[model samples]
Target: MVRNYKRKTDWTEKSKKAVKNGQTIRQAAHNYGINESSLWRAVRNVSAGKSLVSLSEASQSRIIFFLEEEAVLVEYLLKASRIGFPLDTSTLKSLAYDLAIRNSKRSWRTQKSAGKDWLKGFKSRHSQLSIRTPEPTSIARATAFNKTNVGPFFDKLKQLYEELSLTPERIYNVDETGGS
Candidate 1:
């Protein structure tokens, strides 16, 4: 297969190293096999205290959310997952649109929802996260009460109850099929 993707951080460190060693941008570019224009831009950005890794070149001009905005979205998704209300891609896209609107972003105001390309980039950027389909359970496995897992679970629950002195009114259960 022909390799079409540009390596995002390919010359980030090497370019920085060469510049720090007092080499010119052209010299760094030649030594590191990076485009001279790219090296020049990186050097300017580095001098201005910007990140050495070029987000624009890394994303190949497809990025919408800035690094900070993306970080906020990531934190929101993670928090939702921890609380057991994971958002699917469609909902996430809608939420992104909403967030952009609420933040008064003029550029994103034209978009109804985040596009598939944006979603693809988002997933690629967060490749460490695993998105998987839940396995279908057998009726026997579902019905069979597994004492090993359940016993400790309830024990922890009881422990929490005692520690917190929780009332019955404070406890509420949520299931997957329940309506919002």
Candidate 2:
């Protein structure tokens, strides 16, 4: 379920400023109607030299990849998809795992691959990509309409028409060849 939590950046900044200017955490949180711990964290972040906007925009959970790294990954995924070799979720996870391993990510030590939660988050972050089951195609059907078969069939059709001296009006397509 999605939370309807709206961040009051203006009020948060005001609360943080109040805390910085000698107001207690409880008083600031109560005055701003924000969580006391959250206000404390915000004040701490401000003291640590992070801007209020960055504090407000920061995600609660740590992202596995940086923005530029994710951008490169997104580009590769799109290019592969356009070239008719789209990656499935499992393959994507494996690739992510390999990337993490290459980058020496400590958290990925115990896991074989990136988790489903990571895939969910990745999909949410990148709106352009969507998961879908591709329509199945039989090998015979796919290979049946090639130039080798189509050229001869059309040639035979032209020959039959010429031999029979058939006019355009004489041609008719019938669905049923059976009659009662």
Candidate 3:
């Protein structure tokens, strides 16, 4: 659920300044069209030595990783997907659990893995990541077809053909697929 507050950051700052400049909290809040309670809290925070510029909106307390950490995680997921090794939901959850453990975050209810709610929240935060059923592929087929292996195989085949002085007419092509 998103909160559509009527007051912007400048408005809150103006209200706080007005209260500081002898205007009553009610008058400042009414003039700026901000909630009185919120304005009061802002004023209180200012009085308590918190800088006015530092009084920005707070993030959710339940977030396990910092913004930068989450960004790194998102990048890792993207790289993994680009490499034809996209992680499933369970694997993602397990990874999240491992991350939390490594970071010493023990606030989660489930010790084994991240909960479904966390995954849902993670997906919502990172719109680029979507859950999809990946097509089943054989391990050999997936691993053997990459450029690092194919390039060398072709180079070796060329060297072999050159060493044998093979001619195009004497060469035979084999079709493993049994197609005409």
Candidate 4:
């Protein structure tokens, strides 16, 4: 009884080492060129609940927190960008992106939500955070503090009026005492 064998995708030395060192399947896939879902399955085949259970308590918690935050942030950014929000990625990874060929493989589904269905499961966690921070109309007018000409200068004037809205003389007093 001869059975046709599937050619094994050569796992790199680094991937083997990572697996030995108890790195997650996804980590091995990322560190090497292995498929994430495939790597997970191969690891699972070797030992049931072995790799998953070996995860350090701190590391597991960290990943859960990180994923929760990432899901929320992704939704926030996509919505904000659609309606035209600030284009700053000050907190971005600040690294160049590379593409990974995704595998259609999946892990054994535990008694838990999986696949695209789990994508927004933690979205309600982010709903607690207020994305729309309304700037005070007065202070928001004076965006550029150092500009000497036109736009910013005019804004300063507007700011001054709001500041002294209740004062009688209400002079901006922009002209500081001449440089002594």
Give the Cα lDDT of each candidate: 0.74, 0.77, 0.78, 0.47
- Ranked candidates (TM-score, high to low): 2, 3, 1, 4
User: Model 4 over residues 7-97: C-alpha lDDT tens digits?
Assistant: 3655744575688798877788987777888776766655664443332553354232345445545665656645646223222211001
Best candidate according to lDDT: 3
lDDT of 3 by residue, 36-114 (tens): 9989988898789886443233435567889887888889898887665888888888888888888888855456888
35-127 per-residue lDDT for model 2 (tens digits)? 999888788887898856543356545567888878877888888876767788888888888887777775566778888778887888898
Name the runs in model 1 displaced over 4 angstroms. Answer: 1-62, 106-111, 132-180
| Model 2, position 5: C-alpha lDDT score | 61
Error in Å for residue 118 of model 2: 3.0
Give all TM-scores, in the order shown: 0.44, 0.51, 0.50, 0.21
Off by over 4 Å in 4: 1-9, 12-16, 49-180
Q: Report the Cα RMSD per candidate.
A: 10.0, 10.4, 10.0, 19.0
Which pairs in model 4 have colliding backbones? none
lDDT per residue for candidate 1 within 40-124, as digits (tens), equals: 8777787898976444566455446688988998898878776766778878888888877777765455668977776776777
Ten consecutive residues with minimal summed lDDT in candidate 2? 171-180
Q: What is the lDDT of residue 6 in candidate 3?
A: 50
